[model samples]
Target: MCDQYRKSYRLGRRPGEQGPRPLSRNQDRVEKLATGTATTTTTKTKPTTDSSTANATTTNSSTANPSITILTTNPTTANSRKTNSTTVNPATVKAKDSSTTTKTITDPGRAKTRKPNQTTTNLTTANSATANSATTNSTTTNSVIVKTRDSVTTNTTGTSTRPARITNKSTITITKVPKCKTQKLKITKNTLTVGTWNVRTLWAAGKLDLLRHEMNRYRYDIIGISEVRWTGKREIPRGDFIWSGENSNHIRGVGILLSTKAKKSLMSYNPINSRIIMARFNATPFNVTIIHAYAPTSDSSEDDIETFYNCVEEAIEKVPKKDVIIITGDWNAKVGTDNTGWESVMGRYGYGSRNERGERLLEFAAEHNLFICNTRFQQTSNRKWTWESPDGIHKNMIDLVIVQKRWKTSVTNCRTFQGADISSDHSLVLCNIKLKLKNKPRHNQRYDVSQLKDQTTRQSYQARIEDNLKNIHSTCNLNEHAAQIEKAVKEALQATVTLEKTSKKSWIFDQTLDLTDKKRKAKQIKHLSADSIKEYKNLCNKVKNRHDRTKKSGYKINVKKLKKDYKLATAEKRTVW
Candidate 1:
């Protein structure tokens, strides 16, 4: 027997007296036998190695079983069968209906085959079987067809006992979609406090500490300092101190100090010689550009004073017009209590009498459209004057705070603090302004180095360093070794040292502070009574005497130490020679 007939015998038929039937003949016989039946059955079979023989067997089985209307197997060709029907490839099948349509869809990994009859639609894959509608009785009308990859279900007027069976596994795939997200923002308000002060000198010991104390007392965000008396330009990250001074001598200098908040907002700074230093800050509504200028004193010649103002004007011109410009420091010019012709630049609440230098200041302000903030606010004589002569009898508001006329409203208040004592002739002049600033994060860690002044803490610090260094493994790479050394020292410091708590504490004696306070009160009341005046004079003398004694003592000690160090160095040099 042929292979096609042999497979048919195994499927439940004995190929007894008939050869394998042609696919066309089998389909015709199946239709004739199913003409009177109301039931339809579909059988799915496994594919044989011989594809052509498998298709022939599948067709013969449909005729053998009258109820089976559809037969499915793996994609195969039936050209070997002696049938007049057209050859059907694995991807395409055509029915006998004249209007039947066939479509084959090809995908990268999947195949789709479609077969259509005159009144029914059928869709199939190379490995799946699906039937939309099928009718066993030709008279049956409007049959409900339910198609699935695994089975074929039909709802009609007549019922059948046989159920369609599907033996092949179906594959299913599921896809997922994605979503989008949004962010929220927060709004806030902040304040900017600016000030100016002539510190006289930062060359003395404990001067910077005293300055920090006064700065904290007033809670200043940015402060311009004059007469820093430190040669060369340098930036100290601690408290954000930036200063510019004379190249060869500790004569005149200009500096600026920024608090934690202000330092974070600082964009840039330019040091123009010893008398002028300008800094810019990032702020809302507008940026802030401040020029800290230590103009020539009254004793200076006209040429010197003119040159100072000219330099200040050039600095002012360099600032962008959109920025809020503030020229503050010891201008050493007094634009007295008068606002007649200079009403645009000065107010009527000024201190002392105006001088020739003051006229120059007024002209500069008018030319630059700047408003003198010092004269804009009504303040007491004591609070308005920022400097006091040596005898405590003469006081003037030489230290001035000026701002752009357009942004004068931002300067809510401007005045001086007479109680802030830094052993300087000038008081701290502060200005309050409203501004929004961004909070910058800082990671630098600082320790209280002052603790090392004690012998016990010093020894403990040294021991901790030695232990930490001993624990580090030596490395050949210079960079790695340096990093390890730095880490070890930091760890040692953290173990043996304490964090600095506040910059408010000062080294000056409490007795001196009390005496200074008493002297301030005496000065405030000196004009009220003759006894008060006498007391003020006495207090002033005592304070001056105390300052002189302290200075002489410090100077003598410094000279003695220098002499001793020089002798020791000379003796060591001689011995070495």
Candidate 2:
């Protein structure tokens, strides 16, 4: 027990950063101990007359509490006999070394503070060797704060394991508080459901509502929508749905819908153009930026393709180097099963044969070091295809989800959901990825400084600051004085300005959404019957025409409002000047 305690105390000090501690005589002992070398020293003392002579003492004293035993021998003058016995609490004895250093070990169970070059070891009720306060050095091993507790075990690697036990005996559990309470919590992200679909046009009546139902059914964190056909740029938030889009001609449009979970981590969404949109999320260790695109069809001009790719490249370049990027949308490309030299970006599970569009996409992905997630996972023929012909005779996998090659393993599954009813020719292509949301520090509350524009408010604020400064004038410490000054300024500003709550307004009507759903169901029925095709087409045209007029009316109202606001602002500016 004494040997074990001494070893634990001595080894507590970490090795020097300049490499091993020059392997001195003392360090040799440490190395031997580390290598399981067993060496012991023993000393015997002899008593003569009435004096007790000292035994050979070690230069390094043991850290454990010591029990000193003194033996005295006295010659009996009359009887000529000798008696030997032990006495406790003997006089404090200091062992002398060649360097004139004195070593002292206190009484058992009473540990003392360790010296600069000293260490301490103690035994708990369970007789385990534990360091009282081990000083850290250059060793990679972490220092652990150990406490005596029943049914508690700690490892040196900074991990603790607690097993479940059913016992009738009452027990008290004491856990050691972590050294740093402000340490960030470890964030672990599991499988996330992401999807993309090209819903011919979001301008159709009730398309957003029908889309919401499908989104809720799949419980997707984020889903990209293409061909939205919505004019202008804006962010629309309804219930748990949030989307951002930009379109000028009401032609091909792209947008992304985020669930409540994703919304909580939503940093910002940028509407790049009618065919492209980007949203960033606060997934940490690396942020995740999802870019939604509606690439031009194969028949589009080469210049159009070049422009589209240029936009895509610009978007990718905008993301930070440390963040993970995912570009998922309808690429209108068909990459066949032959991975060949493109094994890094694709897999053998790809459906159909490679085409000109597919080659372009492959080249883009290779340049960006991205992997197509759809081709990474294997599935059935129906599950692999994302687009089908109107007559349902032809099927192709045009829509795809691509992620950074470095995070390819984060994509657990990528396939099409053949069952989603979004009243579109394209199937919903879903990709599952694992990404953790970082817990960022909350924004500090700020008072409105605009209130300072008023003369009365400005005077009141100045008076408050003066009053606060007077109250904190007694503070002498430099840090304290600065803190008081800051506090005073903040309080004075807060007293002048009250916080206001603002929310965005929605322009689309619920009735219009209902009509869009009716129109969608009619289209679905028309596909099933050759006779009802004409009626279905007529109903679609009617719905489209009505929505077109509604959009035009809404635009006119917005233009008039803008003109009025501009006039009022101009008059106010002239009066102020």
Candidate 3:
């Protein structure tokens, strides 16, 4: 009995205590304890300590008045022996009717309290009524404790007539969002076909027609013509032929034939000399500058060759550096198969042996950083050679389509078309280039002005103009007034006159076309005997004679028509006078 009494006293229990004793006395002195310890104790008439804690002290209170005590500890201090205690007086705490109090505590930590890094959270809520309802005292005591070194946070919620005070540091964090990105548009590409043909002579009768026929057949956007013996520089709108030659007499000349499409995009053209003619077109990505050149023969003097190349260089210098420069013509220089020293300027697929003129061409190409597109593609001997000897024994690849080395990829393919016959010993050298050309707007609207000659039509036009002008009041601005007048005139013309319907008339007879076709076929024959050559020459002469006759007859017919029109105009003038 005496030993039992001593044990109870050491365990913080009185000798006369009747209730069950605590399990251990030193449990309160532990290094770390469980978090969120909650205790509920009922006393009949005296104060009592909870069974969960041995060191918890309580004050005396009436049976009608009950109190709650909460205790918490910091776990950051591994060797900490201190305890934080909080006590609430029954007289101070007040709760409303039908109110709810909720408490939550979170502690995520290892079993060992010696860990340096541990987080703890504590929440406490209490609700109680006024002192008048002390007799029905129903208290819920909830304690939540979390411990850390310097960081401590607590949340307390309760429904009471009085406000509860709290003292703890807290931290909050905020985040942000990001934005979106935009997209890009796709660009379209187009193909431009550029060709070079050595038409021996445009000065010959019916030669321009043959050239146009071949151009239409091949669908070439631009074809550079060499050895065009046309005297003086002129632009023929019939076939969009822009040629440059000797001012005095028929000699070596260069020209460029443009399709309707090419004509629309043609910005400007320069007739440098009889040997060189340049034309520039507005295209997408870059403008195109085409220089059609007719170089002197290989047997020519060095001074002549130098002078020709100097003129070509001057033309190139005039072109904008950013423009796509395409030099197409009959160079009359053979750059052979070997591309050892001139690998950058010429390719290995070239035909025949290189000559002195070829060496000069290679030097010029290298100096200008240009690529000979003809020599860049592999083709058979027949397709590779651009010109043949008179006896058909010797042939050479002289004509070339040269382009800037930087834009070599733009030239997809370059080769000779042997089937295209323009009464020339040389074959047509064509090149396919990828380019996006700008659309040219048509400005020339050909109205039937001949309708104005009719008296009734003239009166109708005058009446329409008067009606339009009546509605268009003159504005203070001169420009506006002029624009109104122009609009009125245009509207009157639109109402009275019609657009001239141009009927395309083929000038050459079918017999002449058939003869030309036969000539082309005979030239294409692989094995041409003496009889075939004689036949080809005879056919050429016949075609030329027929062309001369047709030309003269057409000229006489035009002169007669002009005389009749002049007479009619003079008679009308005399009647009006």
Candidate 4:
């Protein structure tokens, strides 16, 4: 193609190729470099160069190298073109093609030095109606202005208009969705540090100070306090605590405190004899019962002891099989028995094997998959017994907490905070619990320990966390442990309930089991154990030795059996009495 330059001038000098001399007076600032391409443009408010400086058109492009050619222009000459203050109309440039690759340049002087990676783009100008007709190279090198016929045409008349405004834009959005998890949480730990002291009153006991302080130091979610001296008229000292079991058929006497935050779920209570209170709660994923049992010393009969076990068993049955259960209480009899033959509780309360009520209590728990919580914590059984007599000789823990099958893991850090010094002679106990928490870690944050390579970075992260914690000072007193814990648990339950609301299927509605927790209890019948068996044998021996002085007890049995048979044969409604 034949090229012609009509009225042109270079304000700045080009390198001398064996010429007379090169003037550099016009070099104030270098314009943007282009790849053998240039566009005539000027800011609407500011002009770039003088229009009258147009010099003579001189173009002699010679190529020394085989790859590139140089277009030389004489800088010292001048011409007629005078048009620098003119405005050109602007328009959006569109690309013309995508297939053929074009050479681009950053500087016009270095236009021949085409970079291999430069992508030349042809964008449409206002004068050119074709799509993206204007081309510019992206190479960051020197440039050369190929002044076109349009440049001279602009010089002819001041007719160009202003360009359109170039505006910029952006946007933002947010969304939320419900999700489900695949794995089920498990109760990996269980610990109970409970104390049952006969502290006269909670406030009166100096031990309460140690107990409360110790409890605050450690984290105890559940605690069973015997002889709390709670009048029942007064509210529970703690908002998160629930009471069960106490003086029965009587006034408020003793009770158990279950932690609402630390336990699974509390089901029901059995306040019998009007005093002994027993309430159950769920912790983590397990079910547990706290018993504030104050067995009457006046009624240590085999029947009474049997009734206690029966009541406990009934409560256990109400709980789900998958859930675990625990019971704590104060049994009046040491090594005593019931009407049937079985040992119940531990220790000897001046009672011989003839009636083993204590032994029976132990046996009942054993048969029903229960374990003594003290066995896992204290090294010595004597160390755990609460309520020592003034003389210290009567030291024994009739107060006890036992766990049902496989529920041991739910209890952790069981230890007595204090037992004797507190006002009522009862010591405070403290321990921590491991709740089966849901989504214990943050759901939104991303964790990357890899960046914590050095101590400085780790320290920085630690400092940030500590600062956040310090800023979130908790005003909630008393741990509110149970209440807050319950909230979390209830959230999960509520979610489940919501599913039930939306769906028609339910598995809990039709489930059935053969266990009858109520029938298992018989307060009127006396149970037995090994010691009780010995006592019965000894009784029989004594009756023989005093046969002449005593009415025939063997005959009494014969009559009793006959009466039972008679009732069965007649199909009569017979009360065992």
Alpha-carbon runs more than 4 Å astray in model 2? 1-189, 237-247, 439-577
Listed per model in order, the count of residue pairs whose N, CA or C atoms clash below 3 Å is: 0, 2, 3, 100
Q: What is the Å distance of residue 552 in model 4 from its true position?
A: 66
Candidate 1's C-alpha runs over 4 A off are 1-189, 440-577
Candidate 1 clash pair list: none
User: How does each model score on TM-score?
Assistant: 0.49, 0.50, 0.62, 0.35
Mark the regions of model 3 whose C-alpha exceeds 4 Å error after superposition: 1-189, 442-446, 451-504, 570-577
Per-residue error for 477 in candidate 2, Å, reads 22
> What's model 4's overall lDDT?
0.37
Candidate 2 accuracy as lDDT = 0.62
Sorted by lDDT (best first), the order is 3, 1, 2, 4
Clashing pairs in 2: 205-516, 206-513
Q: Give the top-scoring candidate (lDDT).
A: 3
What order do you get sorting by TM-score, best first?
A: 3, 2, 1, 4
Q: Report the lDDT tens digits of candidate 4 across residue range 470-523.
A: 443356765664465445543433322222111222111111101111111211
- How would you encode candidate 1's per-residue C-alpha lDDT over 224-332 as one tens digit per residue? 9999999998787454789999888989998999888888888889999999999988888788898999998878899999899899989988999888888888998
Give me the runs in candidate 4 sitting further than 4 Å from their true place.
1-214, 231-238, 244-252, 258-260, 263-273, 333-355, 376-382, 409-420, 426-577
Strongest candidate by TM-score: 3
Decide which is better by TM-score, 2 or 3. Answer: 3
**Number of residue pairs clashing in candidate 1, backbone atoms closer than 3 angstroms, sequence gap of 3 or more or interchain:** 0
Q: After TM-score superposition, what is the CA distance of residue 446 in candidate 1 from its true location, in Å?
A: 11
User: Among all windows of ten consecutive residues in candidate 4, which has the lowest summed lDDT?
Assistant: 168-177
